[model samples]
Target: MSFVLLVTLTVIEIVLLVLVLAIMVTMVTRQLRSIAANLARVAFGVRAVETQVSAIGPGVTEVNRLLRDINGTLPRVAQRAEQLAR
Candidate 1:
């Protein structure tokens, strides 16, 4: 009789431990899914920003060229102004 009671208690303890482990696994799985969804959204936003930056590249290059042209003429203009001052 004593042996039978001991076996029953051991089985109950094992069942409770398995139940607790299952709950923990389910909670972890839910959190992982949420993180995956947020990461996907972030990836989409990054791609959109990349597309916009690519579209602006040619305009930026044109502006830089214009600035370079102005920069090249500045020294001659300054020299002329100095001559006029004299």
Candidate 2:
């Protein structure tokens, strides 16, 4: 082949290779972005669960307080009933 033809072929080959690499890079970047978005959504869901679980402590505390109040009143009622029986 003539030197000029060989040089032209080489240039075309280089350009094609560069284009393919660019396309592959863009595809990979797109996939990475999608994965990052999914991970963010998962993180948000986890945070919501954490907030719900954290609230359970105070809820349980309120229930315990209500039970204690009810228990305290029962003893007084029992003592009054015994006195009446005497």
Q: Pick the candidate with the highest TM-score.
A: 1
Clashing pairs in 1: none
C-alpha positional error of residue 81 in candidate 2 after TM-score superposition, expressed in Å: 32
Taking the tens digit of each residue's C-alpha lDDT, what string does model 2 give over 6-71?
999999999999999999999999999999999999999999999889979888999999999999
lDDT of each: 0.98, 0.97
Clashes of each: 0, 0
- Model 2 sits at a Cα RMSD from the real structure of 8.2
**Worst ten-residue run, lDDT, model 2?**
51-60
Query: Model 2, residue 65: what's the lDDT?
Result: 97
Model 1 clash number: 0
Candidate 2: the clashing residue pairs are none
**Candidate 1: misplaced stretches above 4 Å?**
61-86
- Per-residue lDDT of 57 in model 1: 93
- Compose the digit string of candidate 1's lDDT tens values, residues 4-79: 9999999999999999999999999999999999999999999999998998999999999999999999999999
